[model samples]
Target: MIILMGIRDDEQVQRLISLDSKSSLADVVTICRSYEAAKCATSAIRAPPDQLRAVSAYKKGKKNKGHEKNLSTKPSPTTATFCKCCAKQHEPIACPATQSICTSCGRQGHWARTVQCPANQAQCLFCGHVGHYDKCCKTKKKDGRQSGSSGNSSAPNNNKHQDTRINSCRHLGSAAPTATKTPQPLNVLVSYGEATFHLLMLPDTGADVTVIGKRHLEILGIPQSSLQPPACTTTLTADGSTMAPALGIFKATLNLGKRSCPARILVHEGVQTPLLSYGHYKAIWL
Candidate 1:
C-alpha cells in the first residue's frame, strides 16, 4: 500500500502485516514500496485535467465558495407540492426519507423512474434477464414448444420460507447491494483541540446524519464519560451492519480550508471512518 502516489511508509507496512497476519513486515513493505509500483501510483493520482473529473469532489475550484455551493445545489421538488412519486401526503423536497421507498418492490433507494419497475419479479444475474427471483431461477415458457426447460417462474411462491433474500434486494431482478464504499484517510484534516488529524470521512448522499468513528474519539483521548446520554438511536452501516447503543452526540466546530461550521455528530462504536453526511455537506455551504 502506497501511502501517497505509491510512496511506501511505515503506516502502510503495518497495515499490510495486520491484514495477512502471517506475512513478514519487511517482505510486505518491499513489495508495496517497489519503484515500479510507486511510479504507477504517482501517475494515477496525478492524472491529467480531463481525468480529474472523476475526482471532482476533491477539487477546490476557483469559483467563489458561495457560487460553488449554488452550482451544486439540487433544487428539490417543490416542498408545498404533494409527492406523486411516493403517493405520500408530503412535499417531495421536504421528504426526509434516507432510503428509496416504492410499493412495487417495497425496497429502499430504488426510484420509480426506471425503464421498467421490477416488482415481484425474478431476474437471474446468471441468464434469464429477470422473471421472479427465488432460490432457483428458471425461465418461464413464453412459447408452448420447449426443448429442455420451462416453468411458471413468476409471482411470490416462497411465502412459506420465512426468510428469503429476495425481499432484501433493493429492486426486482437485482441483488441486495452492499453499502457504498470510500477510500480512507481522505487526507482531509479535522481540527480539534489544537491538533489536526488526517481523518477519513465518507460522503454519503443518502445519510441524513453525520457520524464520527469511535476509533477517532479514542485516538483523540476524548473520554466517553464526557459525552451526553444516548439518544436511543441506531445507525445502519454500509456493509449491511448496524451500529447500536449510540455512545452520544455533541456539537463540534469543524474546519476545512476557508470554511468552518459547527457540526452535530452521532458517536458510535465499530465505525472505520467518520461519515460526512447531508448535515456536513449543508454546513460547508453555510
Candidate 2:
C-alpha cells in the first residue's frame, strides 16, 4: 500500500513499490535519494574514458614532429675565415707584409686576420666562424678599399654597378655608409638626495634624456614614484645611431669627473652603449 509521490520515472518507482509493498513511502524516497547521491559522487570522482582519449589526441596533434625531423636532418652553415680586428668574414687585410699587431689579442708578428685561433679549435664568438676565437675576430674593420680611388676604368665601372645595387636595396633613399663613431667612456657623478656618488658616463646621442643606474638611484635616495612619465621613451645613440626608448626622467645630481652639477636624470631598462652624448658633454661643460 506504499504510494511513491512526485516520482518522474513512474515505471521504476512502481517496480520498486511492487517489490516491497510493506515498506513505507518515506523509506522508498530515502533509498532513491541515496542512489542519486552515489551516482553523482562516482561521476565527480572519475573522468570519462573518452575525455581522456580526446586530451591525448589533442596533445599528439600539437606536437612538432615535422620540425624536429627537419632540425635533425638539416646541415649547419660552413664555417668561414674571420678577421680579428674588423671581425669580417674574409682573409685578414693586415697581411704578414704589414706586420701589424693583432688589435684583438695585442700580440706581435701577425696582422689582423681571420679569427682562426691556432690555440683553440672552437669558433670565434664574434664572427661565428670556425678556426678562430673571439679575441682573433676582426669583423668590425672598416673597408679601406676605395673603388674610384684606384683610378682604373674597371674599378670605376665596378663601383658604379655596386652603387646601383646598393641604391636598389633601399626604397626611397640613396646608398651611403651610415657608419657612426665608436662610443667612449666618460666620468659622471651621481647624487641621490643628499648622498653623492661617482659612476662611468655613457653618452648616447640616441638618447633624448640622461639615465641613472638602479644602484645609483638607490644610493641617491630618489624614490621610484618621483620619476615622471611612468614609462620610458624611445631614443637613438650617436654611435651607429642605434634606436632605443627610455623609461622616464628622475631628479638627480650629475658630476662629470671634475665637479658636481645639478642635472635631470633619464632612466633606461637596459644598457645599449658605453658612449657619451652631446647632452652629457654639454652638462659637463656647464
Candidate 3:
C-alpha cells in the first residue's frame, strides 16, 4: 500500500503517527512527501502551451487597432419660405393668408364666412349678406333682418363651443385630465447645542426617516455616540439589489415656515445631501 506523509514540525508528525498503528516500514510500500508533491504542482503551473501563445498574440493584434468611431451626429437646421401676406416663414398648409372677400364689409383679406361689416354694424357671414364668413357676424336675430336664420338654428350652443375649443387645444390624443396635488418646497433648519442651521423644506413621503449627511453633522459640532445600535434592516435600490442599511436617527429641531417641529434626524453614512424623508414630513406636517 502507498503512504503519504504531511510533516509539519514534531507535534503534527506525532499526531499523524497516532492515527495509524501500521506506520511501520513492513506495512508501507511507497511514501510520498509533502515537499515533493508541492514541487510537482509548481512545475505544472509554470509550463506554457500553444493556446496561451495564441491568446497573447490576439491581445497584441487588438491593441494595434484604434478605437471605434461613434455613429451618431447632430441634425442639420431646417429652412422655410416666407408667406406674402402674413410675412412669416411656414409651409403652405400652416399659412393664415386668405383670398375670399367679405360680403358685409366688402374686404378682400378674409373669407366671406368671417366678414364683420363695421359700416352697417352687420355681420355678413351670419346674416348671409354675401361678403363675410358666418363666424364674425355680431348682429342679434331680433334687432336685424335674419338672412341665414335656418343655419343659425342648427349651430352649437356656448357650452359645446367651449368644449370643442378645449378638445382642439389638447396635444395628447386620448389622455384624460388627472387632478394632482402640487408638491410644495420645504424649509430646513439645523440646531446642535448653541449653534443653529436654516434649510429648505423637502417633503418626501416615501422615505423611512429624516436624514442629514455627515458633512452637515460635522459642521454643527455633533459628537458621535457610542451607545447607538447598528442598523439591521436592508434597503432595496433602483438597481434591483438590497444593501445593508447604514442609517441612524438623531435628535434635531426643524423649522417649517412659521411653525417649528421637533424632528428625529436620520444620518446616512455615505450620503452628501440633507433630505427630509416622506415619513418625517407626513408625521410632522400632514
lDDT of 2: 0.54
| 229-286 per-residue lDDT for model 2 (tens digits) | 7354345543336454555576666676575556666666665433334455545632
Q: Taking the tens digit of each residue's C-alpha lDDT, what string does model 3 give over 1-286?
A: 4254645557545545555665665433233245457667877677678757887899987765533212234455567776554456788667564664554445655333331233232212223232222344444233234334433553455455546444533422122112222246566666655668776545543345666666666766676662155457666432336645654566777765565667777565776656676545544554
The C-alpha RMSD of each candidate to the native structure, in angstroms, is 35.2, 21.2, 29.4
After superposition on all CA atoms, how large is the RMSD of candidate 2?
21.2
Per-candidate local distance difference test? 0.54, 0.54, 0.51
Model 3 residue runs over 4 Å out of place are: 1-185, 225-227, 237-244
RMSD of 3: 29.4
- Model 1, span 92-207: residue lDDT tens: 45554436664333456544433233533322332223333222333223222232222333234434221343333324223222321232233345665566666657655346
> Model 3 — TM-score against the truth?
0.31
Error of 3 at 187 (Å): 2.6
- lDDT for 207 (candidate 2): 42
